[model samples]
Target: MSNKTPTLSVTIRTGRGKGAARRARNEGLVPAVVYGHGTDPQHLLLPKLELNTILRNYGLNAVIDLDIEGTSQLVLARQVDVHPLRDYVEHIDFLVIRRGEKVVVDIPVLVEGTPMGGTLTVQEASSVEVEAEAMHIPESIIVDVENAEAGTLVTAGDLNIPSGVTLVTNPEYAIVAVNEAKSAAATEDEIEGDAEGDATEAADE
Candidate 1:
């Protein structure tokens, strides 16, 4: 994660309900709510393009400094709702957070390097849950499979987690595995074997 923090200036939304939210979108703004730390939910309007840019640069767990009508509040982009057909951001839920606070988030897993010849690397898990400081959350975890032999299993415990980030997922959770790639003939044989097994089972019955 980069040390730089993204800032967004927004205004408190006055209107309510679906009508207001639709109007905000028509004006290129996304309706959002901020709530956390036992505070009442505050409705706000965010720039659609700016919010998308921040998420693109920092990922879903981006920590943002929201300038709400001249007051700055530290927050996390906790949830986002998007239009299923139009593919635009509809609403967002921001969670208020403080500096040095521990937050649990699911970080994406990235595979690096290439496995040994004739073996293919298969990702078993896409992301893992971890707890880290609000400002120091890692964007993703990397697993190196360079020259890895077939049958080598990479578990969550094997991930290269940065210091200060505690893994919340089970240590035994499988992440990736190196396996021998199957050839066309081998695939055909498996299909034939299944068919024969079905016939034998029917005869026995």
Candidate 2:
């Protein structure tokens, strides 16, 4: 895993109309808002092409070094709004954070290895609610599923936490479990039924 970070330089924009926003996008910049630490909300323009590349690989918690008109700040990605079908970004919200500050963020849970005999079903895909420092937030939480027997279950409390991190979710939430798969014959029956229905419609046509 690489520990490289992305650096971005932004310029503050005072215009607040649709025309002003369109001009920024035409020039390959994105309209963004920055707010935190009792300061007023600052309208910012970021280089969209570069910021998109960084966010694509790093997810929502990516950190950025932002420069607004020669002023530098360390910030964390907070929220983003994008077009439903277009590739353009509609807006982005960045939270300015200081080092050593305790920031609460959700970390994704990754299951390692298959359950014993490949007979397990993931009851829940993700576990929510966690707290960590602004700079020490983990990329993800790993849950070991190696050789787990039937009737075995893993919960959010079973997660291993690194230093400077804490779990804030319910301790009893089921994250993964072992179960018997539905018989292949049962699946085939459903498929066959659907096929027959399709054929009947074609005949009617």
Q: Could you say which candidate leads in TM-score?
A: 1
RMSD of each: 1.7, 4.8
lDDT of 2 by residue, 123-159 (tens): 5857567888777678888888777877888888878
Q: Which residue pairs collide in model 2, if any?
A: none
lDDT of 1: 0.93
Check candidate 1 and list the clashing pairs. none
Superposed Cα deviation of residue 16, candidate 1 (Å): 2.2
Which parts of model 2 are misplaced by more than 4 Å?
A: 1-5, 186-205
- Give candidate 2's error at residue 95 in angstroms: 1.0
Runs of candidate 1 with Cα error greater than 4 angstroms are 199-205
